[model samples]
Target: MAARTITNRKARHEYHVDETYEAGIALTGTEIKSIRAGKANLQDSYARVENGELILYNMHISPYEQGNRFNHEPKRPRKLLMHKREIMRLLGQTREKGFSLIPLKLYFKNSWVKVELALARGKKKYDKREDIAARDAKREMDRAMKNRHRE
Candidate 1:
């Protein structure tokens, strides 16, 4: 089966990602089921190093439709599994000013749920404007190139 991915589109627009890491997530049975059905959202989700562990906050995995009272919470803080050394390194990096851990995507990797986490710095308003302008220019150039090739 192909991998199903849930992405945080706003994360890229809001932050300048510097590094990325793949980490496993601790999920309950219902949560996994919900994710497999593409009922998950990574919007506004972020990770933080706390007491030697990396914890994910604000991730929303919708409750399974068939699940009853045992259904998992839609929004919960989940733990991200990574090596101690890596966690320590991330902690160190995040300690610097403006650096934060953001969840970029969630997907199934070989039957295991994996999270693509990024170490990023928040972008300023002008930076966002610049990115938008550059993207518009790139789009126009691509359109021109496509027309030229077709002509």
Candidate 2:
């Protein structure tokens, strides 16, 4: 494993993920180089099934600093490779009400660039508030436990 991670922080904050899939990404040489340099962003990116194929949009791989005219586009749509059945299943899930495809994270596994795509539904306003409150409470409880252990 190359041990690189490109995370979509906002995705977790804004949506409730129901399922996840790992899919390979097709990339140019320069794009791979940029990713190896940790110059990729999945923050505003998303994946969609288009014409029976999965395509990732708005995923930014910064131009290779050393490549002059051969650098890949910073925000081009990249094709995601997966089994036909898996793509069809995702298409069906996304076609259902309140379901979407979100790029959760990008990483390299055994030299292959892979993306973790989430089958998600948008979180309502009150749901987001409750999630925040739960997270805060958990943090406070952990802190209290740590203090008690130290004393």
Candidate 3:
């Protein structure tokens, strides 16, 4: 796997992810430079397909410190690069009820910046609670097993 430069960890807890796809991002020079410096955040960011193209919204890539007047906007809607067929498939999926297009992660892929877009369904409040409980149970089990093995 290539290096995951940034991620939206909250997305996993908030949605039931169905499928994920990778697409290149259209970033300005300063935007890319800042991202390389680990100054990007995916909180509250999402993606959508529009007019046969995929667009990312609310992604915050901080301006390069030395960019001066050439820095890109901190929060801009950037275009995503993906195949037409993929975009069409996403369009079909998104047309269904309660389905959404969301960006799961941003990463460096062979020297290019790529975003991992997920097809997800929203989770209910009860579902979130259940997931938290299950995770805690699993962590306790792992810790108990480790203690036994150490004896």
Clashing pairs in 2: none
Q: Which ten residues in a row have the lowest lDDT in candidate 1?
A: 1-10
Q: TM-score per candidate, in order?
A: 0.96, 0.96, 0.95
Please state every model's RMSD to the true fold in angstroms.
1.1, 1.3, 2.1
TM-score of 3: 0.95
- Model 3 score (lDDT): 0.91
Show where candidate 3 strays beyond 4 Å: 1-4
- What is the per-residue lDDT of model 3 for residues 1-88, given as tens digits with 9 covering 90 to 100? 2234798999999999999999999999999888888889998998888989999999999889999887899999999999999999
Better of 1 and 3 by TM-score: 1
Clashes of 3: 0
lDDT comparison, 1 vs 3, better candidate: 1
> Residue 120 lDDT in model 2?
95
Model 2 regions more than 4 Å off = 1-3
- Candidate 3, residue 147: Cα displacement in angstroms equals 1.6
